[model samples]
Target: MNASRLLLGSFLFALASAASAATACAPTIDKPWVRSAPPGAKSLAGYLVLRNGCDAPVTVVDVESLDFGMPMIHRTVEEGGVSRMRPAGKLEVPPGGELRFEPGGLHLMLMRPLRPLADGDVARVRLVLADGRRVFAEFPVRRAAP
Candidate 1:
């Protein structure tokens, strides 16, 4: 009787694992990282590359982080010889396309961390898409570039 119960549990676990794997989104996240900030800093920035392997467009509507008070998508634009940061409402990735968030360009503005995040720490973020798909990515915190 114990053996039979164990086998049943294993089968259920396998079935659930397969279902979760199948439901995961097709967009692959690479090079996810956040810039290290000083203690008591009000905000920090993160960057990453998102590659869409699906045949249809993927729209990333929101970003959320448990460690931070707010995670917002932003872009740095230069106008009139001045650079300013602006909120990026939504970013869309085309089929077989790639979106890059880099320095001096698009980035994730992580505001009001619950605790101080130093270098070598990992921050988990969730990406919410327009199609009701939620994907997670871990961003490693690194020292700022000199």
Candidate 2:
């Protein structure tokens, strides 16, 4: 009976190790940054670099910001003598690849600012993955250079 119990314990340990190994290779984000809005500005933008270390693709479904009324993924498109902003449905990060949210490109649109964000202020944002996992990060507010 003791031998049988030992074998069961070993099997459970191996299973746990495998599960941990599989989860360790998931996509993650690093060094998120948000632009500081000017006084009386009602909206701002945020940027970040998402890294996919896994062998499978990951999709960013939604984003939540504690400092803004609404946070959504947005992309800037330039047409004939016109520039417009639109919602980005789902951001996909390819396997072993990366996605950059930068200025004049894909970025986070923070609307209806709850309070004016000053320089060097840190805003906490949460990104929800398609798999229902929530990744939290702190984005620092920086002045946009003219």
Candidate 3:
């Protein structure tokens, strides 16, 4: 009986260690940037490339930023020659795969700035995952893609 209990405890410890290791290699963001808007603009757009290196899939449930009052995942769609922004829910990145946030596609819709952000400024953003893990990045404000 004592040996069985010891084995179970060891298994639990290994499971916790594996969870920590997976988060340590969480998805990485590349080329994170916020499109530069005019001074006093009410809203802006942000873009990034997410590359998942974890052994399991990663699902981004929401976006948040201290620089903006409302940060969300949005996608641009066209209908009847008109373009519209729609909420994109739960973006998933497969293991060893990549997801992109580009213009006219999956992108960040940041609204109601806390302060005016200009070219060469930085916006701190956080991507909240479904498993309660958060990935953070500093997106530079730029007029063009880089």
Candidate 4:
């Protein structure tokens, strides 16, 4: 009877450890940033680095910003020697990997500013993950040199 009880305890411990490991497999965000709008400019852009710690891929479905009327994922493409902005449907990050949004690449297009953002101010942005997790980030406003 004692041997059977010991085996059962060991099995329970292993199950608990497995559960903890699975819970840790979620995506994380780091160093979220945003570019300050130029004087009198109505819109701005944001960038960030996302790390996927999960064993499965994660998709970013949408973004929400309190300071802008609408937030959309956008990318800059060059066609016919002209550069233009286009909408990105969704942002994806691979398992145990990272995705970076930087200048001249995939970025958040913050449109229709509700109010003027001053230098050194901070804005709150929320990123919605496909797994229904919401990540909140505080992006600083700084002057982007021309």
Candidate 5:
């Protein structure tokens, strides 16, 4: 009957729309920022919130920045009243989940700046994933908190 045919057509259209939306979904970087260091400082820290909107997990294998020589993921560890920072190697974000990089916790160690960065400067960085996907984001440089 025509009524059944109409219902089926609507269902198919809805399914197609959902599929298209899913394909359009991509990982996003939110609130990206970098800390301004002293004039002679060699290294600095970057922070951001990475969100995974796809259906599969994404692994951030490496990070690169045009302003810095080598950027790496690091975690702060505290034990016996002492705090230390260590490389995290790689980070994974589950589907529909997010990873937060903040001070006194997970952060990006940007080393050996090619040029000095000042407050209000924007730093461009790329997040390389294991699946050969690269996500680019611009981080605004902010003054270091006192």
Candidate 6:
């Protein structure tokens, strides 16, 4: 009886692992990272590359983070002589296409961390998709862009 129970437990664990792997097969995030900021700073920058391998477009409508009070997607634009940032509403990645979030361009505005994040710490974030699915990514906090 004990042997049978052990076999059942192993099968369940394997099934759970396969489910997680399948969810990450499409619309994957690569090299997600957060830039380290000085202590007491209100905001920090996050960068990552997103690739969509699905048949249809993947639209990221919102960013959610337990580590940050407010997390948003933003684009940096230069108008005349001034550089400004505006909210990037619903960034879409075409099928088999890649979208980049880097410095001086599209980035994650990680505003007001719930707790102080140190270098080497990982910030957990979730990209809420338009189709009601969420993709998860872990951004490592670093002094330089990764």
lDDT per residue, candidate 3, 14-37, as tens digits? 999987786787899999999999
| Candidate 5: clashing residue pairs, number | 0
> Which regions of candidate 2 deviate over 4 angstroms?
none
What are the per-residue Cα lDDT tens digits for candidate 1 across 1-146? 99999999999999999877755647888889999988889999999999998777899999999889998999999989999999988889998999999999999999989878999888988888887787789989998642
Please, what is the TM-score per model?
A: 0.81, 0.83, 0.89, 0.77, 0.80, 0.82
Per-residue lDDT of candidate 4, residues 99-124 (tens digit): 88778988889888888888888778
lDDT of 5: 0.88
| Better by TM-score, candidate 5 or 3 | 3
Tens digits of per-residue lDDT for model 2, 54-124? 88888999999888998899999988979899898988889989988889998999888888789988888
Clashing pairs in 4: none
TM-score of model 6 (CA atoms)? 0.82
Score each candidate by Cα lDDT: 0.88, 0.86, 0.94, 0.82, 0.88, 0.91
Instruction: Write down the worst ten-residue block by lDDT for model 1.
Output: 19-28
TM-score order of candidates, top first: 3, 2, 6, 1, 5, 4
Best by TM-score: 3
Best candidate, lDDT-wise?
3
Give me the displacement of residue 10 in model 5, in angstroms: 25
Alpha-carbon runs more than 4 Å astray in model 6: 1-25
Stretches of candidate 3 above 4 Å error?
A: 1-12
Worst 10 residues of 5 by lDDT: 18-27
Q: Could you tell me which 10 consecutive residues in candidate 4 have the lowest summed lDDT?
A: 137-146
Error of 4 at 135 (Å): 1.6
What does candidate 5's lDDT look like per residue over 1-146, in tens digits? Answer: 99999999999999999977755766899889999988878999999999998888889988988889988888999978899998887799999999999999999999998887889888888888887678899988898632
